[model samples]
Target chain A: MTPQAQRDILKKHGLKVTAQRLAILDYLITHETHPTAEMIHQDLPMISLATIYNTLERLVAAEIIIVIDSLSDGKRHFDYYGQPHYHIVNTQTNAIIDAENFDVAPLLAAARQASGLNITGFHIEVYGVNPEDAR
Target chain B: MTPQAQRDILKKHGLKVTAQRLAILDYLITHETHPTAEMIHQDLPMISLATIYNTLERLVAAEIIIVIDSLSDGKRHFDYYGQPHYHIVNTQTNAIIDAENFDVAPLLAAARQASGLNITGFHIEVYGVNPEDAR
Candidate 1:
């Protein structure tokens, strides 16, 4: 999103418009891969680790981004776009890719039917060796 | 499983049978909920926190248990059976229950077809409020 749009988003969420916040969201907007705070800090050297985490927490609270904790690694990953989606991880490399437009309705139904539990959100992740690594 | 069966399974995994290990596995076998190392540690006070973590790692390495990294909370959860199953978390209570016999073959096939990535394994979790709490 444009700087203006990001600023508007912050305002809409009752957040302060700051350069640090803008930079963090902008990085996520440009990078397709879901990233951790360390990755964001690495990408933007000007941003400190503390700032990165604080901004991420604010964005997540505002529902602008979502935290993904399902990867093989124990680290927390952030998704800039909070829309519903799934992810697949490259086990060896720990690389993550978004699985867009994947449907989980059938799987959710199956679980609800089998367990007799009131199903809610589904967090799905697939792990495998990236084809690029095999080359 | 019976005591003999447990012992045989441990032997098959090349793990020596110990009272602490047996106690840990026994707790998991009886408790359907996916538990954290801290939970196990709390239940088995005789086992040190370090020992609990070590045993969990050993069992996970042996493929006897699987680590779940997806829940809202950051702590690591373990599934003892290591079978193909899903989990649902109670958002309010932070309670986790297994979604047994819930197949993910369809979801897996869909992800593979969409992403064109060689998917190895799928982790699925649902979050909702347990109805029992409403009572």
Candidate 2:
């Protein structure tokens, strides 16, 4: 997106636009693969790791990005868009692929009734070894 | 269960039964809520934190206990049983409640076809504020 558009997104999320935030946001938007904080840090060596981590926290708080926790390992992946989706994680390679959107309303409703809890959001990660890797 | 039963579980998983492992397993079996390594350490003051961590690692490798990653924070909670079920996390209180079992076969199939990935296992965690706590 344009610089002005990036600023508008930051403002919309009630976040102060900064060069560091813009860089991080731009990186996330451009990268198709779900990347961890470390992966992002590697590509942008100029930005300090602390700043990357801090920026991610603010972005998540603003609901600008979502955290995808890998089940294989405890590492987290960040997504720029807020659209609802599940994940397909490669168990051996630790590759994270977005699974198609599956309606979870029925599951959520059943959980609400059974647990008597107000459901807000859900995370689903499917783990598998890639077929090529298996072969 | 019984002392012999516990030992059998360890042997079946190719884990040599040890006092520390037994203590950890016993605690997990008795406790209903998912407990983290640190939480387990707090309960078993006699055991060193490192030993607890090591034992948890071994247990996980043995497929003895499953790790439940909390979305509110990144902390992992441990459960002894491996039964297929989902978790309902109380966002406000950080309480982890087991959601009633919902069949996810269709969802898994769709994900496999779309991603061309051989799916082995999956984790689903629903986040929400408890109605009772909200009141």
Candidate 3:
């Protein structure tokens, strides 16, 4: 997110734009792949895990991003992508790959008719071996 | 899965249907809601967590069920339902609830057109506080 847009969103979510929060958001936006909180803390060495956790929680509350809750490596992983997307999980290694394009129409239709829910939105995780690695 | 069906799926997955495996499958079928390996161990009493884990791994490989990987309480939680469905998460308490029905046609269409790819299926998890609990 741009500096101004990030600030605007933080304000909208009633969150104070702290350096830590901005940094976390910045990491989320610019980071190429999905990462866990521990990974985030590791990347921003100066930041404490607690701060990352707090910032992520605040971000979720503000609806600025979504927490994947994917424990890729026996640890909880978070993906802060503002847009909706699905993840392909490497169960063997617990690696997370961001999926850019996959149409979920047939599956969604089948699920909706079966469930009868007020599904506001959905977070998806597909646990599987990487196609190439499997080969 | 019954003894016969269980044997069939195991054979299909090229797995050996051990007694432990049968027990785990029985546990999943008769159990209500979704239970992880730890929870399954706790419920079965005599079974070890390791056994549960192995059984779950085998079942997933057999394509009999999907691994949820929902760490509702910072611990990996598994949903054994063979059917495709969405989950309602209580972010506050990290509770998992099964949502019976919701349509994803519009959203799927949007995602499909935006990212062109063959979507075999999708799994959804809505990370939010329960509406009733929120009130």
Candidate 4:
């Protein structure tokens, strides 16, 4: 998305539009790779780690982004919540790849029946190793 | 499971069988609520929080229990890994319910094809609200 679009999203979410927030949001939108605050800081060296963390917290609170802790690595990974999709985490490389082929409606239905809860949504993390890494 | 069984399992995992470890493992086996260290300490008040944390870390390291961080509560919940199953996290109550009806083999296959990863296992957390809480 364009910088203006990112700024508008921030404004819509009642977050103050700032250069740092715009950069972070733009980066997540452009790069589907789930990144931790430290990784984001490494890429956007101009932004302080504290600022990146603060911005990420605000974005998460606004529901414009989501925090994923399902990885083997203990760090919190951030993903843009613009679209609905599942994640495939590489256990060997600790990479988060987006997988959108399978439908989760049936699984959600089963969960609703099994748990007797009004299912809202779901998060599925498939753990595996790359073919070459498996050997 | 009996205390002896728990002890044997711990020994099989190369973990020293201790009274505290036995108690914690038995508690987890009896209660599938996916409790955090604080919750475990609340029930096993005789055990120090530090000890509970230490034992939990050891159990997790031994692969006797799995840690779940998918809940909205932001607490790492522990579950005995006696059997493979999925989790249904009640977003409102933050309760982790075991869901076993749905088979995830197809989903894993799709993820493997989609991401080109040699599929090993998967973790699914279906978020929802309880029936009464939903109304």
**Candidate 4 per-residue C-alpha lDDT over B1-135 given as tens digits, one digit per residue, 9 for 90 to 100:** 677888899899898888898999999999978889999999999999999999988888777888898776777889998888899887777878887999898998899899988887777888888678644
Q: Say which prediction, candidate 1 or candidate 3, comes out ahead on TM-score.
A: 1
Candidate 3 chain A: minimum summed lDDT over ten consecutive residues — where?
A: A111-120
Off by over 4 Å in 2: A1-4, A71-74, A132-135, B71-74, B131-135
Model-by-model DockQ, in order: 0.58, 0.72, 0.27, 0.83
**Positional deviation of residue B34's Cα in model 1 after best superposition, in angstroms:** 2.5
lDDT of 4: 0.86
Listing candidates in order, what is each one's chain A TM-score? Answer: 0.74, 0.83, 0.76, 0.84
Error of 2 at A123 (Å): 0.9
Kindly list the per-residue Cα lDDT of model 2 for residues B1-135, writing each as its tens digit.
Answer: 887788888999889889888888999888987988899999998999999989988887776887886556667788886577778888788888875568889778877887788887777888887576653
The model with the greater lDDT, 2 or 4, is 4
Per residue, candidate 3 scores C-alpha lDDT tens digits across B1-135 of: 568986676677788878777788877877765677788888787878788888787676555766666544555556665666677655566556666566655444544444443233456776543345433
Q: Classify candidate 4 by CAPRI docking class.
A: high
lDDT of each residue in A19-134, candidate 3, tens digit only: 88888888888885667788898889898888888888777656567666544345555666666677755556655667656555554454444444333455776555434553
lDDT of 1 by residue, A45-83 (tens): 988999999999999877788778856567788887656
In model 1, which runs have C-alpha deviations exceeding 4 angstroms?
A70-73, A110-120, A130-135, B114-118, B130-135
Off by over 4 Å in 3: A70-72, A88-118, A125-135, B84-121, B126-135
Q: How close is candidate 3 to the true structure, as a TM-score?
A: 0.73
Candidate 4, residue B91: Cα displacement in angstroms equals: 1.7
How do all models score by TM-score? 0.82, 0.88, 0.73, 0.85
